[model samples]
Target: MNVPTEHLLILSAILFAIGMGGFLLRRNMIVVLMSIELMLNAANLAFLAGARQHSAQAGHWVAEGPVMVTFVIAVAAVEAAVGLALVIAFYRRKQTVSLDRLSPTGATSKAN
Candidate 1:
């Protein structure tokens, strides 16, 4: 049975919202990275949903959606690598992964 496109879109929206909330509310570097990944996956879901809907119309194919998802996955992999590397470096220097502890100017906040 084919699922409705609206359902897929709604699921994607919920996933994206959850990811956004996690990314914004979490302080740990790892959780933040995971949240970013979650957001990417949600976007991938949305792309696939759109493609499915398009392909259902008059035998029209939508190849770009999967291609875009592939690109997104590749970029996400690179982002994870670089972000983890930075996290490692920061952890080595500060021994903590709290976002509030790391200043944008690379200065460490005073420990409370």
Candidate 2:
């Protein structure tokens, strides 16, 4: 059984679309983060497909592209950690993580 490069490109596009939809529709910060990660992976897939179709030496580097992806993943991990920590702290004071409830103007009150 042989598959075509165009099929791979189509699959990548579909995955990217689904990821984008998930990112936009979900309100929970954690789910949104996962969706964003999915989108990144979809982009990586497309990058590799293009690299292969063009017979570019850079395509071979596509397999190595995960090193950069790993760095981004690490940054995302740190971001999630800090963001969740902030969320917890905010919830402790405000009791909600909903975006609508978060306000920069006088939303936080100093605990005496």
Candidate 3:
């Protein structure tokens, strides 16, 4: 299907805004990680929108967007895995996943 680039960009912007809000406002580590993922998806959508628009204008196949998207997805997956692992470790050490409970160094207390 041929969707308008403007609409796609608008959607991406909205998603990114929401993600940024969640990341900044939420105290839960898991929620913050999810917000990051949402932001990443928003970026992917923007990339696809640009690629589609370029393809339509040039009347040819373009692989740049899709290729970049693939790399983004891979990187996102790794980010998620590492983030979740860290969250788990944090919870195990602190008994809570709330960011507010963490100290300036991100630990529950002095490591000492």
Candidate 4:
């Protein structure tokens, strides 16, 4: 059972597109952040597949790739933490998570 590189590329492209769509369409900050993470993972998958297809893939350690992925995951985690904190504070002040209710000036109605 052999898989072609083209198939992997196509799959990666599709995953990236779906992730982008999710990021664009979602209003929830958490969901949007997750979509961004998905897009990054899709790109990482494509990079690894391409590396596998190449004859002279640098570095003997597979851990290198995973380390980079781990870094990305850490970044995503930090982003999620910060974003969720902001969302929580916003909800506390405004009583809503809807993006439409958020104001740029941080002035929320007290009548929630």
TM-score of 3: 0.92
Clashing pairs in 1: none
Better of 2 and 4 by TM-score: 4
lDDT of 1 by residue, 16-101 (tens): 99999999999999999999999999999999998888888849888989999999999999999999999999999899888877
- Residue lDDT tens for model 2, 1-112: 2456788878888888998998888766667667777777777777666656655544444444555556656876787788788778867777766555666674564541
- Report backbone clashes per prediction: 0, 0, 0, 0
Once model 2 is optimally superposed onto the true structure by TM-score, how far is the C-alpha of residue 67 displaced, in angstroms?
Answer: 6.1
Question: How many pairs of residues collide in model 4?
Answer: 0
Q: Score residue 35 of candidate 4 by CA lDDT.
A: 85
Give the candidates in order of TM-score, highest first. 1, 3, 4, 2
TM-score of every model versus the real structure: 0.94, 0.62, 0.92, 0.74
lDDT of 4 by residue, 1-112 (tens): 2577788778889989999999889887668777887888787787666655662345454455566666777877888789889889887876777776766777864544
lDDT of each structure?
0.93, 0.69, 0.93, 0.75
Candidate 1 has an lDDT of 0.93
Best by TM-score: 1
Question: What range of 10 consecutive residues in model 4 has the weakest lDDT sum?
Answer: 55-64
- Residue pairs clashing, model 2: none
